[model samples]
Target: MRDRIKTDELLSTSDLRVSTAATAWRHVEAEYVDEIDGILATLAPSGPYAYTVSPRMEEGKEIPTQRIVTTFDEIAETYQNLHRFAAVVAIRPVTQLHASWYTFVSGLGRGREKATGQESERPVIVLFPTMGSEGITGELFWGRTQRDSMPGDPADGSLASRFAVAKVHDTLLDAYRSGDVDALTDLAHAEIQAGLRDYEADTGTLAEMHTREELRRHLERFFGRYRVLGIDVVTSHYDDWFFFHELRWTVESRTGDDAGQTYRYHTAEYAELSAEGKIVAHIGHGTDRISAACPGPA
Candidate 1:
């Protein structure tokens, strides 16, 4: 029996993080600090690359502020810090989110904080995508997240095949991009549920839809407001039960106060699929700072 079963079959978990877009991030962070130059070379062009973190705030009602570090020089300075080299622990691969984009949560020790005897653990989120020859280009976020669960065993043999998940996902994306409501109806189950958790919104609302009819209405409202310029799947991961993908979208507002303005958004979504390969549940979250509004094409 052992000889007949494949090596992966013996493992209880289905984490493909080592093979996903997170590979370069894991490599760079795990290597000796002196190897930073070679690792930085793996990042995408420096102009667009960014590293951001949530500002430290006192325990209270004060809202957190964002501090972004751009430019290769600034990014290098942060990575070269001695404390930045601390070992990463408790890594959890967040799947079923971005199409081709992927992210993981891990803990890194912050060097000497106040009078603490030992380094304090800070949660870090490493978000990345495979950019052609750039390999794994990532945006490292420190102190943005406070908690995450550890990795777990794979689904109990109930997961769908990669091919099945990818096929439906591609069709759905095409339909969405084209505003093909009929095609979308064919792809969604009668009991479909969908929602968007727009983190960029000040209200922090998770807008939801419970049935195909509700989804249709929601999509109609969305299409009415914005004309999708493009949607590029940056990276993705899937199993029998869930398909996770990160996508970058460019759209122009058609009906709001911001009409005639274009914006670029980075979003992640995870969809739960039924046995028949139809989407039963879909949840999405906005992942990045939206680009400044620009004039739409004439």
Candidate 2:
């Protein structure tokens, strides 16, 4: 299809149906591009809240799996995101085709109802793409349940407490990703303890990064080796006085000679706050499933 819109001309949609009709615009890749690079948006004549991810199908599986690749939106949207989430995934078409398949969809996280603004889990769309004799074939799943949840009611404790931890959550995330050890130490207490591991793979008890100095050195070493490409949020929520977040991230190596090699990884982090809302303990687990081939090595 000769149809192509410069990224600037496109208005992000929240009601558009993602289907064969969108194939012509497959070149319309969003910055939020995923697997097959198919174009997906959420919009419809009904309103801005409607979302759809295409090749609507009855039964199928996501290929390479859908990982949270960015979290800025989750934190930016403040607990209500599903109504406006967007994503793309790779999948083998339910109807086999000689051509390759890819999908683009919107509405990954959930939004809250209007009357109460009380948040509840909502479904996001997953769309698929396929090439056929007729051109492009579509597969889609509707009402796919979402895993992210909003912070619990402040009535359980106090708005001050909830907001404090939420803010701390934001701050600590910033520090962790930026490798700002000084910021981490300032946010965390003197006795702060940190643990990191992989949820899907057991690498052992993790390094004993119990002291601020250890944490600083560990982060410095990590930042020295890999350059973070991007980070996506799979889930971000708060419970009691604790905050937790799961991320799907991509990082490229900058150390040694494999500087350009990229690795896809996922991690979950949990942090508990002291009575004063200072982070006391932080634990993280990560996994790198897909092996990346660096041109230089064996």
Count of steric clashes across candidates, in order:
17, 29
Model 2 worst lDDT window (10 residues): 43-52
lDDT of every predicted structure (CA atoms): 0.54, 0.44
lDDT of 2: 0.44
Give each model a TM-score: 0.46, 0.43
lDDT, candidate 2, 116-226, per-residue tens: 555443333333333211222222233332132335456655565667668778777677667576887787655555555421122322333555676677666777777
Candidate 2: segments with Cα more than 4 A from true spot = 1-157, 198-205, 289-298
